[model samples]
Every structure is written in C-alpha cells, then in structure tokens.
Target: MGIFEYAPAPESRAVVDIKPSYDLFIGGEFVPATGGVFKSVNPATEEVLAEIGLASDADVDRAVAAARTAYERVWSRMPGAERGKYLFRIARIIQERARELAVLESIDNGKPIRETRDVDVPLVAAHFFHYAGWADKLEYAGYGPNPRPLGVAAQVIPWNFPLLMLAWKIAPALACGNTVVLKPAETTPLTALLFAEICRQAELPAGVVNIVTGAGETGARLVAHPGVDKVAFTGSTAVGRSIARAVAGTDKKLTLELGGKAANIVFDDAPIDQAVEGIVDSIFFNQGQVCCAGSRLLVQESIQDELLDALRRRMGTLRLGDPLDKNTDVGAINSAEQLARITELTAAGEAEGAERWSPACELPAQGFWFAPTIFTNVSATHRIAREEIFGPVLSVLTFRTPDEAIAKANNTPYGLSAGVWTEKGSRILSMAKRLRAGVVWANTFNKFDPASPFGGYKESGYGREGGLQGLEAYLDV
Candidate 1:
C-alpha cells in the first residue's frame, strides 16, 4: 500500500477542472507542437497530472521568430506606461485566480498547499505588481539618461519555485518592453502553462510572453538560439556553467541565478529558541528544495549540543504527507532523481564520519519521500557538507568565534545567501559586512520581499532578480 493510502486524498477539484494537455503558448494562443509530447507526474502520488508539449528544435525556431517579430514590431515600440498597464492587468488576474493557482501549484510541483497559497502565489502576484510600478519609472532606477529594452529574452527556470521564478523572469522582461520565450522545467510545467492563460486573459499582446515546456534539450535550444538577445536561467551550478560556456562569444546578454548551500550561523548570544525556528524554517521549507536553504548550520560550540537537541525534537513533530493538506509541514520530494541524490549524499556524509540522524516517522510509500535529516560532526570536506543536496538535509558544524563562523560560512564557492542569529546589533552588522554573499539575513532566515534585490555572488551566478536591480537585467543601459 502507498503512503497516501493511510489517509484520505485531499481535495483536487480546483486543479482537476483545468485541462491537463498543454501546448506551446505562442502568439497569444495555445497551439499544438509539431514535435513530441510528454507526461508530467505528480511527485506526491506518482500519478500523471498532465501531458505537455515537448518543443522540437523547429518549434523553438518558430517561437523565437515570433518573439523577434513581436519585439521589432510591437513590444519594443510599446510605451513604457502601456507595458506597465499590461503587467498590472496580469497581476490583477493572478490575484483573482490565486486560490486556483495555489492548488495547481501544490498538485503539479509537490509544494505544500499552505506555502503555495500563503507564500508562493501571493509573492508571485506581488512581484508582478511591484515590477509593474517600475515599468514607466525607468529613469528613476538610476540607469542613466535612458534605458533601452533587450529585444527578446529567453528564460529557463527551475522546478523548485516554478510560478514564482517564472514571475521573476517574465514580469521584469515584459515591463522593460522585451518579449520573452520562457521554458519551464519539465518536472513542473503546469503553472507556467496556466500563467500563459492568465496572460491571454489580461489581453497581453501576442508573442509578448510565450511558454515552451520541456526538459534540458529544449532549454538549451532556447538559450543557444541565435535570434535570442538575452538568456536568464535559475537551476543547478553545473548547468549554469554549461550555459555560460554556451553563450560565451555570443552577444546574448546572460544572467544566471544558480545553486547555493547557504550557511545559518547561530552565535552564543542568540535567542536559542528563535534561532532554532529560523534554522528549521530555512532548511526545511519547501522540503529544502530551495537553492538558498541554510543547509550548513554553524553553531557556537557553547550551544551546539543544546541547539541540536532542540532541532531534533522540533523536526520530530513535523508531519509529512499530502502537499495539499492545510496542516502538512513537509511534502514529498520533487522527483525520484532528487530523492536518489539526497540518499546518496546522506550516505556520503555517514561514510565521511559525520553522524546522521532522522526523525522516527513514517514516509509515504507511493511518492518520492525523504525524512528531514541532519548530519552532526560534519567537516568542511565532507561531500554532504560541500555539495548542494537540494533536500531537507542539514549539516551541523561548530564554531568557536565570530571570525571562525564567517570563515567557515564563506568556505564554499557559492555566495548566494547567509543568515546570522544574534541579539547583538553591532555583531550582526559586522558579520554581514564580512560575509561575501549577495543577501544576508540578520536575526532571520529565508525572508523574501519583491522590493528586495536577490541573486548571488561568485559561482552562485551573477545579476539580481528582484527590486529595482531586476529591471536592469532586461534592459540595455
């Protein structure tokens, strides 16, 4: 029997009413592709949720041609205020359909319904709304006397935060008067397709926003297509490097928001209970599929044992099951491949002499599931400590001082984000300055706002994704 067999299936009528077979959204219409079709599975139950068109090279060409034509004839020439109005319309439509979108996101992407409803969907709408305000105010964004749009942007987003990432990519591109051909990751493509419909509902211009769904091959074709003027990606560090090489000599402007193994540092002066909560939320939210998850927990030696005991006790209480449940704290792993990767890395941590611990809880049999795991006594050289596990796995390492903690946190090549927990305000500021990350959260972890700029430093990839900085990625300054 499957894990879900022990409980009643959650309500799915909101997702069921929507058509499951989706095609390429091109020229403001959903049209069948001339190539192949693939089925998208629900990770929670290993059930087929939908069949989506897999774009062929020819289909990519057609989409690019349409985007280019739109850029040259309609999009680029559109007034900034008009572009702003269109984004506002889309944002309003998203707000109207927020519940439906949340339900679909939970079903298609395996994120908890509470998070999809309260966090992802709301933030997705807010991102569009915030960037909409920036459309006509380019001059105020400190870009110089004038800013011009990049002709056509090709974006490929990851599965972790599907619709939200799509919003981050598309809203700014469209607000800057650039047409886009976006490819959503294969594992979670339905929300992008649904957003395409929302665009149609808002009467967005034909070819202004096109979504092509497929795996890596389609994304590569979209990014490397000669007609595309810009490329934006959010995924693994390995693929980000490949994309950098792929676009190397081309004039295609590139922005990559790649992988991260962020560190959450808890000093001796920190409020242990609050710090523990933030640490738990940082690493376990989205089942730790988040790239910016605080997978590395650095605690002061004085409180390491106390914090670990508290964390283990808290993790033991977390309920993991159907994503659509209003009460579920942890959901199924996104895919079988992801589960295997987590399993492999967890074993590596144990092999390398780190002690592994998981809560005594039952996992669902049907879907890809992993218990929230932590590795104590982890060294910086352990594969589990160094690699991006991309699951609800935390590696605990102790530090003796603030300088040591900062050194240990910045030890990795990734500099996307980090967190510091302390009651000392001066220490927070000092540590934030010394840390070489793009985003530093003081006394908190994993907080996001549409008004805040977000991205990475070093190998975590370049360019900003939110706030005023995001508009620059789509514009020629």
Candidate 2:
C-alpha cells in the first residue's frame, strides 16, 4: 500500500458568528466607540474575522463610570450568596457555550482548537466556578473579619489566552463584590465581547462587568482613571512597568501578571521521556506565547545530548497548520508585530554564536508562523536565553551542577515560573525552596488549576491571581 497524506479535518467556522462590526460593551449594552474601529483577522489565514471598535479615553472614562455606578448601586450592595449565584450562572453559561467560545478563540487568537477547548475555555469556567465558592465564604477567607470590595476594578488582558486571562482578572474581582471595566487585547476582543453577552445571559446587572476594547491607550486611560479602585494587567513586563508608573501617584491597587523566560531544568536522573514531553509542552504549548512559558532549557551536561535528541524527535511530531483542526498542535503566531519580535530575537541568537535547529515542519504561506525551534550552545548571556522571546523558541544551556542550574534559572529579571525535572523527591523539595520563581512545576510543566495561586516575583510582576490569595487583590482589608 502507498503512503497517504492526512485529509483536512477543519472545524466549522459557522460555530461562531462573527459580527460585521462589534461595539464596546459598556454600562449594560453594546455602545459605539468614539475611537475608530479596527479589523481582527484570523491569524491562521489572515482573513478578516470582524471589525472591533476601539475605545478612546472618553470611552474608557464612560466604562469606568458605569462600573462605579454598578458597584455602588447593585453589585456591591448585593448579598454574598446572591453574588455567588450570579457568578455560578456565568460559569454555567460559559460551560454551555464553551464550544462556540473555543472555536471563536481559535479563530480570533490563533491558538489551536485543542488548547481553546481543553485548556482556555475550561480554565475560564473553572476560574468562575472556583471564585463563586469563595464569594459566600469571604468572611473566613483569611483577609479579615470584614473584608470589602474595591469600588471598581480596571482589568487589561493580553491577546494570548484572551478569554482565560479575562476570567483570571474578572471572576475574582466580581466574586469579591467589585464591578469591573475590562480591556481585552486589541488583536483579540471577540471572546471578551462574547463574555459580555454571557453576563447578560446570566442577567448580571448593568455595568457590573463592562468590556472596553482597544490598544494600549485604552488600557492606560483605564488604569489611570481616578474612579477605578483596582488595576490588574497581564502582558509584557515593559508594559507592566509602564502601568506601574502610570498609576504611581494614584490609589489604584495594582496586580500585574507579566512576561517570563522561565527555566526548565532537567537533571540527569530525571525520567527522560517525561522530561522531553515537559520540555515540548513548556515552550511549544500556545506557540510559546504563555507568560510563564519555560523558554529557557537548562539540561544537565551529562544528559544534554540524549535530552536534545528526544526533544528534537518530539518537536518533529508537532503538527503546525490550521488552528481549527482537531489534530493541530502548533498554531499561527498571534500577529505580524509579535512575529517580527520573535524573528528579531531568534536572529540575534544566531548572530551571537548560538546554534539553532528546527524540525522540518511546513508552515502556511499566508499567515504568521514560526516552527518549533531550539538553540543549542546557548549561554546565559545570550539574548535568546535571557530575553522573553514569547514564541515557540527554546534556548538550551547545559549546567553541570544543581547549584549551577539554580543560579542560571534565577539569572533573569523574570521570576514567574520554572520547572524542575528530577527523580529525587528531596532534591525537588530543596530546589523548589531555592528557586526564586513564583510557581514551580515539579516533574511536569504548565499545569494550572483554579485552586492554586499563580503569579510571579520581581519584574515578572506581583500579586496572586488564583485561590484565596487572589481574593485579596480585589478586596479592601
């Protein structure tokens, strides 16, 4: 029998009906934007998906005013049990429309359908579900005998994991009795707008949860808005710094979940097969756009060659093409601008004497796509190893000792996440204590749950986003 190619099994685009032009979801309804509209394209095909309205400073001000009004007149005055019920409704609605949302997320954000279905959408629902339970139990949540909500929260989420990041920002804020004005990333606003419909479906009060779509200026206006009591952001570290400076003199409570160049350390004694899979999932999942992605690989010197061989073999099998395909592993880059950043960083890695290798994977000609790439002979000083590439690119740097691995892993300005692969339980515990990152994955990589608190130390940004710790960010102690 002759070998055959796999037939295309694309998911139907009809699953999500993209509107001709979307307006800002402010107060209680979809309102027109003062700023002009922009097109959101399917990164996999460069096809225009929908026209998204951009929010100017005036729109942001209006949204914040709505949030404040809702917080004072409705959401804040509502009983805890009632608030919990509303969140529960939102969670149930999200689960009900998960398929539609996942397909839309894949189209608008360029993540594989597999991820949007299994990871993003599920986590979005899980965050609401988890925070709902906390809503009625806030008295015992360890904050204080009486905790109060911040009046209005200004939340800005990144394009990567658009809906999931919104859940991270909004669920806890709402659960804690604060109304929110959320800004989804410019490249991906469809899901957040869809979430606005979800709020209406839940019969959530007008202005309880408003979504204003735009670029950085919109976010800047939101965070700096005097009426906003809290500000939360998830994106680049440089932008996080800018937000920090923007709200410096203000009373806005800030929590930033920013960029990372997390180190994935592999010891010689680690289970090689599992370690290889962890390495792939760490950097390749979501096309490595994850804020806590393990972009830096520190393999023990004795196992470097063996680990690299396994990693290369694994990378070869990752299917990169249509994000809507059920079998696709890697998806298109989120945008042209982000692709250029990845390209520049990777080229610098090559120019600085690092050896780069990529599996022979074909990419679509029309879209922004970068293949699963790895660089050997990488040093701690190399730009690819040190900087946040935020793409499916890994820098392999070998370490001979556990102390050296720890040293190299904490060398960066980012301390969001790290993974340690080892068979020794004692060593894992010891190293976990030593690692400066906020979240550490032992034996596995990129695992997240609603019960666990997630955030980072140092420049990776501050404040927890899950579990009981997350509640404090939106609460007044």
Q: Which candidate is the best by TM-score?
A: 2
lDDT of 2 at 196: 93
- Looking at model 2, report the run of 10 residues with the lowest lDDT sum: 1-10
| TM-scores vs. true structure, each candidate | 0.97, 0.98
Predicted candidate 1 versus true structure: per-residue lDDT over 1-477, tens digit per residue: 423333444656554455768889888888898778998999999999878998999889989998988899998998889999999999999999998999988888888998999999999999999989998998889988689998999999999999999999998998888999999999999889989889889988899888888889999999999999999999999999999999999999999999998999999989988998999899999999998999999999999888988998788778888998887889989999999999998988988999989998799889989999999989999998899999999999999989899899999999999999999999999999999899999988889999999999988999999999998898898
- Residue 27 CA displacement from its true place in model 2, Å: 1.3
Model 2 off-target regions past 4 Å? 1-5
lDDT of 2 by residue, 169-200 (tens): 99999999999999999999999999999998
Q: List the residue pairs that clash in candidate 1.
A: 3-365
In model 2, residue pairs whose N, Cα or C atoms come closer than 3 Å (at least 3 residues apart or on different chains), thus clashing, are none
RMSD of each: 2.7, 1.2
The number of the candidate with the highest lDDT is 2
